[model samples]
Target: MEISGSAFNSGLNAIQAGQRRVDQAATEIASNTLPQAPVETPPAQQVNPSPSGAANTQADLAESLVALNVGKTEVQAGAKVVETADEVLGTLIDTRA
Candidate 1:
């Protein structure tokens, strides 16, 4: 088995991508959870809260949470790949001595 620079580069890229994903998801979740001022409704019209709107927000929150978890897993896997590549390269160098 041979380990090369490409393997290291791929791992690094994966780690970077995963980190970006995690960051984006966290930002989204934060924004979604922020409190908003209540809007005043006219006395003549009764305002009914849309259940669908609430459901949509909940769905988005769920998706963001999932993305966050997936990103963490991706980073861990990438780190392992990089670690394995480094170990293999070190062993190869040691055998040459």
Candidate 2:
């Protein structure tokens, strides 16, 4: 099945949104003082890309897809981080206010 542009766009937007959430989470976490503070790894750090093609377009496409999937996983992990941060922030703010 061919993917429509709109569908692709939707997916991209969702990914972007998730990334934003993750960033917000990390920021919130950074602002607080806690025991055993978690080490947050950025998405780019998790993915390593090597050129997969030797003057071959097919191999290039495969490499690109691998990179894309890796990116998606990073974004997902980020989203989880964001959610965790959001929850912590909410609790703190509620207690302080």
Candidate 3:
């Protein structure tokens, strides 16, 4: 089946967006400076608690890595779609000529 140019453009756009997300995630992971989500504790449960920076950081890192992996997969899929579209278009043009 043939794909339109707009479809190909959309695929390329997806690739660009996915790459940006992957890069941002990598940078955050490498720098270890991701912003932490505020931890909320009920007043009743607020019994003196020790600092949890280490735990928070570990959880954040894990989440960031997962996001990075997902972004990488998106980029790969987008690139494949664009590639296939290009090939199909090329074949169509050749056939027309």
**Weakest lDDT window of 10 consecutive positions for candidate 2:** 1-10
Candidate 2 Cα misplacement greater than 4 A, ranges = 1-55
Q: Give the number of the best model, judged by TM-score.
A: 1
For candidate 1, the per-residue lDDT at 32 reads: 79
Q: Could you tell me the TM-score of candidate 1?
A: 0.85
For residues 1-97, what per-residue lDDT tens digits would candidate 1 score against the true structure?
4345887988999999999999999998997788877777777785665578678889999999999999999999899989988988888889997
* TM match of model 3 to true structure: 0.74
lDDT of 2: 0.55
| Better lDDT candidate (1, 2) | 1
- Which sequence of candidate numbers ranks them by lDDT, best first? 1, 3, 2
**lDDT score of residue 81 within candidate 3:** 85
* lDDT per residue as tens, model 2, 1-97: 1233344445556668656655655444443324454567687895654444234545544555555565567677655555655666677678889
Which candidate order results from sorting by TM-score in descending order? 1, 3, 2
**Using alpha carbons, what is the TM-score of model 2?**
0.40
Instruction: Tell me how many clashing residue pairs each candidate has.
Output: 0, 0, 0
Kindly report which residue stretches of model 1 are placed more than 4 angstroms away from their true locations once superposed. 1-3, 40-49
Better of 1 and 2 by TM-score: 1
